[model samples]
Target: MARMFRVLGFFTLVIALMSFAGDLTEMSLLFFVQTVVFFLLGYLNFTEKTYILLFWAYMVLSFLGFTYWTVFRMGLPF
Candidate 1:
């Protein structure tokens, strides 16, 4: 169960990144949804301490990427 959650979280992160890289214009919805899912999965699987650090790093990077894409690429008012 825990391993499955970890795998899902990892894949979510990858999908989020790929979505961002593929189409910044169309990624807003997908990225947002994936991020929310990643957060929920991470929270629910908090018992896995080994991957916690990596997860946090991925979260931070994803957030920064999303912000950058939205504010700079999409030209949305920050």
Candidate 2:
């Protein structure tokens, strides 16, 4: 689980760099923060269940945030 988190952190770092290159500074900062968090959490000696729960929480929060952004911020003509 820790290894998985580390891998995710690495991927998020890549995303952050790409976003920065694309001039999406806000998104790049967000991903950079997440990368730091995941890396920190990866170093912690947490139980497997805790890690799984944390991952689930992260997923739910991210999904809700994305939904909110699309529905309210995107201003789509619907």
Candidate 3:
């Protein structure tokens, strides 16, 4: 069960990264939602603290990338 969540989290992370290739609005929304889902899965299913920490790192990085693309690249005030 825990292993399944880890695998799902990895796949979700990959999909979230791939979403960067799409429209900025869509990418932000998709990545944000995916990150939240991954975090939830990690918190609930991961026994090891390392997995949870890794998910948090990935989520923070994903948010930073989204912010950069939306604010700097796209010239949005957000």
TM-score of each: 0.43, 0.96, 0.45
- Please give the CA lDDT of all the candidate structures: 0.67, 0.97, 0.68
Question: Worst lDDT window (10 residues) for model 2?
Answer: 69-78
Scored against the true structure, residue 11 in model 1 reaches a CA lDDT of 74
Q: Which residue pairs overlap in candidate 3's backbone?
A: none
RMSD of 1: 8.1
Residue-wise C-alpha lDDT for candidate 3, range 9-76, written one tens digit per residue: 67766776677656566755675686666657655655677666765786699799978988888995
Model 1 bad stretches (over 4 Å): 1-6, 9-47
Superior by TM-score: candidate 1 or candidate 2: 2
Query: Which is better, 2 or 3, measured by lDDT?
Result: 2
> Can you list the residue pairs that collide in candidate 2?
none
Clash pairs, model 1 backbone: none
- Encode model 2's per-residue lDDT on 1-78: one tens digit a residue: 999999999999999999999999999999999999999999997999999999999999999999999989997896
Could you give candidate 1's per-residue lDDT for residues 1-78 as a string of tens digits? 456555676776677787777786466466557656666765665566646666677679879998998888899654
Ordered list by TM-score, greatest first? 2, 3, 1
Q: Summing lDDT over every window of 10 consecutive residues in candidate 1, give the lowest-scoring window.
A: 1-10
Candidate 3: misplaced stretches above 4 Å? Answer: 1-47
Model 2 residue 22 distance off true place after TM-score fit, in angstroms: 1.2
- Give the per-residue Cα lDDT of candidate 3 at 35: 60
